[model samples]
Target: STIAERRPERIAGLVYLCALLQPSGATPADLHRHDPDSALVAAIEMAPDGSATSIRPDAAAELFYGDCRPEDVRTAIERLVPEPIGPAMSTIDTSAERWGSVPRAYVRCDRDRAIVPAEQDRMIAEVGVDVVVEMASSHSPFLSQPDALAAALVEIRDGTA
Candidate 1:
């Protein structure tokens, strides 16, 4: 979204997959704070220096890949790494003439624990999109429902979603 907003002329459309879709001037952290049902914030472990955050490995499966295969979950957990706090907390800057003019779409995950369904709906309502596709998958749909995810992406790319 930020990239599109910054260089709308370079991109054709925007497709967010169970992502933090905030309005201008609002950070992703801001949206996560309002989602009381989301389990992601609670599972996050901040570094002592507060420069990074990590999800507890034990909680990873439930929060990110609830519907994924056990093997996939194990693989993902093995590759887990601390995420820098700066980007996650950065506020998005957009304008009606740029971001708003670009066609936007969202692929919502109904079983997501990371972003939660209500939070996803809130974001869709807060920032209107040209398309909204729902899936019976978790936050990590790539691991849980790759086929469906791919199909949705294809439809979005084809402008038929």
Candidate 2:
């Protein structure tokens, strides 16, 4: 289903369901990922490194706003990003607006193609997040550097990163 444009709060309900998916004892695949803290780390560790090709827009119009569409890049975005149209980055707004009410942490991927440092910084400051960790890898550093990702997540977990 298409997002009911502008109905941002429904996204939270979605997140709640996501968290409940793994309520204590569940299979790894059946499990949900959750942290009571609203700390959000876009973990740009694997942010896209943008190719020179034309791109198709992800559901987020913001991503395709200022670029020309190269047929190949357009093909890539469509092919690469799976659906359920997850991540709901649209939910990022909900997380930011409620930052003061919950702990917020951010991990910015140094080589993220989707989010360069400047825009990422703006988002951090705008949200007044509690912590910001920079990981020096493209969008999916967790895949390539689980240790670092684990370390960062631990810091967020222990409140000592």
Candidate 3:
């Protein structure tokens, strides 16, 4: 969603999710259509604050283990936390002027299997980022390439890229 639509209080920067970018009114079922073999609809129990209190086993397995190495996936699953995602948050307008005004960066996970490289590239092109950094890792780069991800964040923060 546009910053104006979701969190208008902030300004200047944007960190778009390079993994999955869906159109308005698109449901989780659409992801399954995109990748029937790997994309699993996560069974999430929502809390009062719009965060997921729990993710079912099947969902977790598909999300974290599908593309990552066994050992790395285990670490990510262990550290996974409740992610805040409201229903309205999914309906983003990429064409909105508010989104276009902000400086943005895209981190492309080249080895990501959850969101394939082609899909990531398509989103990057559609969203229009100021900088693009390629990470030779899976969807969960924080688990597979923490130091590199940190460095990319630093570079983006410093406007060096």
Pick by lDDT: which candidate is best?
A: 1
**lDDT (CA) for every model shown?**
0.90, 0.41, 0.63
Q: Show pairs that collide, candidate 3.
A: none
- TM-scores of the candidates in the order shown: 0.96, 0.45, 0.65
How would you order the candidates by TM-score, starting with the best?
Answer: 1, 3, 2
Candidates ranked, most accurate by lDDT first: 1, 3, 2
Please provide, for model 2 over 30-91, each residue's C-alpha lDDT reduced to its tens digit, 9 standing for 90 to 100: 21133222112231123244322222344322232223235533553555442232333223
- Among all candidates shown, the one with the greatest TM-score: 1
Runs off by more than 4 Å, candidate 2:
1-99
The digit string of per-residue lDDT tens for model 1 on 1-161 reads 78888899999998899798899999878988797656788889999999999999999999988999999999999999999999888998999998898899999999998888888899999889999998999989898889989999999999887
What TM-score quantifies how close candidate 3 is to the native fold? 0.65
lDDT of residue 101 for candidate 1: 85
- Write the number of the candidate with greater lDDT, choosing between 1 and 2: 1
Candidate 3: segments with Cα more than 4 A from true spot: 4-9, 22-72, 79-90
The lDDT of model 3 is: 0.63
